[model samples]
Target: MALDALGSPAAARDGMLDVTRDGRPSARIHVTSRGGEGRALVLVHGAGVDGSFFGGLASAFAGRRVVTYDRRGCGVSSDALDGDWSLDAQAADLAAIIRKAGAPADVVAHSLGSLVAMRALELAPGLMRRLVLIEPPLFVGLDPADPVFQNLVRAGQALAKGHTSTLFMLALERENMGDAIRPFTQDELAFRERDVQTHADHEAGWMLAYKPDLARIRAQGVPVLLCMSERSASTYHARNQDFLARGMGADLMRLPGGHNAPRDYPDEVATRLSTWL
Candidate 1:
C-alpha cells in the first residue's frame, strides 16, 4: 500500500476497503490515485454531482495521487444513510476515507463538498494539508426569503415526483451543458438524473442546513485557494465567490467557462491550477 501505487481498480489508493458507516443497503467507497509519491490529494464533488465532476481537475493533477469518490446517496454511493445527512455527516465520511487511505493529505473540494471539507477540518484539524475550493454554495446558506430557495424547493418537489428526466432537460437547456452533458450520453444522463433526484430530496437537507463557520475553518490554518468561473462575472456566483473568499480569508482565482468549467474546460482549469499546485 505504498502511496505511489494508489490507482488499482480493485483497491483504493491505500489498497484498503473500509466502510466507515453502513446502515444503507448500497453504501460503497471508491478511491483511485492520479499518480504521485507525496501525500494523497483527495477531491470531493459538489451537491447533486458525483466525483466525475472533477474530470478536468482530476486529469490535470494526474501526476499526483488524487482520490475522488461519490458521496452518500449520490452516484455510486448509497442514498439510504440515516439521520440528518448534514455537512458534518459528509465530513465524518471524509475523515474515515482519509484514515483508511492513510492520514493528513491535501484536499480539493467543490461546492457542497467544500462545506463538508471545511467541517472535516473543524472535526479533525490535521486531516488536510491544504484546500482548494471552487464556488462553494455556503456563502448565502439557505435564504428562505430568497427566490432561489423557492425555485430550489419547487425543483426538488418536481424531482421527487419522478420528474428527473424533465429536470435534466431544463438543466441542459438552461445550464451551460458542459461536455458532461453534451449529446446526451445515457451514462451521463443517468448520472445527472441521480444527482437531480438526490438534490431534490434529503440531500437538500445537508445543503440548506449549512451555516458558515468561518472561524472554525480559519483556525485550521490551512492554505486555501478559492476558485470560480470567469464567465460567472455577471452572475451572483461572482458575488458569492467573493463573499466566500473574504469570509474564509483565502485567495480567489478565476477559471474559464461558467459554473461547470471543470467539465467544459478541464484543460484550462488545470492550467490555472498548475500555478498553485
Candidate 2:
C-alpha cells in the first residue's frame, strides 16, 4: 500500500477479549477476523506496544482470520505488576491463543513478538503452519555498544516519557495519525500516552534481555519469513534485520516503505501475503 492509501479504513476494529490457560496469566487475545479459507493467521504485537499495533495490517487481511492481542501488561491484558514474564512465559500465552482459536495457523509476529513466537514453537512444535516475522530486533552476538543498541535505548527512553503520539507524529510527519487514532477517540494522543506508560517496566525488562533471542530462534529451525522495509537500508536496525534474515535462512522480503511498514504500507503487506502465503 502507498503511504497515503493506509488510512482509518484499514485500521483494526479492536476490543477486550480473553482465553484460558493453566498455571499462566490468563490470555487476553483480540480478534479481527474477516473470514476467508486461507490458513488461520495469528498476529502478535511487539514489546512496549499492544496488539493494536497490528490493527492496520490485520484489517488488510480481511479475507482471512486474523487474531491480535496484548502481551501481559499491555493494552487490555493483565499488568504484571510483580510477576513472571520470561520469553517462555510470553510464548505460553501465545500457545494458549493458538490452541483456543484452533489450528492450521500461520503466526505473523512483529518486533519483540517475533522472538516470543519463536519460543512458543519450542513449547509446541507444530503450533503453526508458517511464521512471518516483521523486523525483529534480535541482536545476539552483536556488540551491546553498537550504534543500533544505543539508538534503541534512546528511543525506548523517549517512548517511556509518555509522549508517544506526539513523538510518533514528529518522527513520521507523513503518517496520518488523525485517521489512525480515530477508533481510539479524538483525544487519542492521551490514549497513546497511557498505553506507553502501561508497559514501562515490561519494556525495560524486555529491552535489557533482548539480544540473545536471535540464537534461540535460529537454533529452533522453524519455518520463518522475515520482512524488512525497502527503506531499511538507511538504518542500522534494518541492516541488523538483514543480518538476521541471512542467519535464519529466512526469506528477506521487502515492503514499500520504512521501519513502520505494517502501519505505513498495510495494503502492500496484505498484497504481499496474498501472494506469499
Choose the strongest candidate by lDDT.
1
Off by over 4 Å in 2: 1-27, 30-32, 141-145, 150-191, 211-221
How far is 99's C-alpha from truth in model 1 (Å)?
2.2
Candidate 2: residue 5 Cα off by (Å)? 30
lDDT of 2 by residue, 1-277 (tens): 1111111123334444454455544545444443344456788876556666666787788677677766776665665533665676678778866765566478888766777887787667667888888776565634568765555555555666865554333333322221232254232233455456644544544543554445556666667788876766645446476567766667867776666667666777889966766
Cα lDDT of model 1 by residue, 5-88, tens digit? 443322234332334455542335444555555677788887667776765567676466677777777776665446445666
* Candidate 2 worst ten-residue window by lDDT: 1-10
lDDT of 1 at 144: 63
Candidate 1 wrong stretches, greater than 4 Å = 1-17, 21-27, 80-84, 141-187
Clashes of each: 1, 1
lDDT of each: 0.65, 0.62
Q: What TM-score quantifies how close candidate 2 is to the native fold? A: 0.73
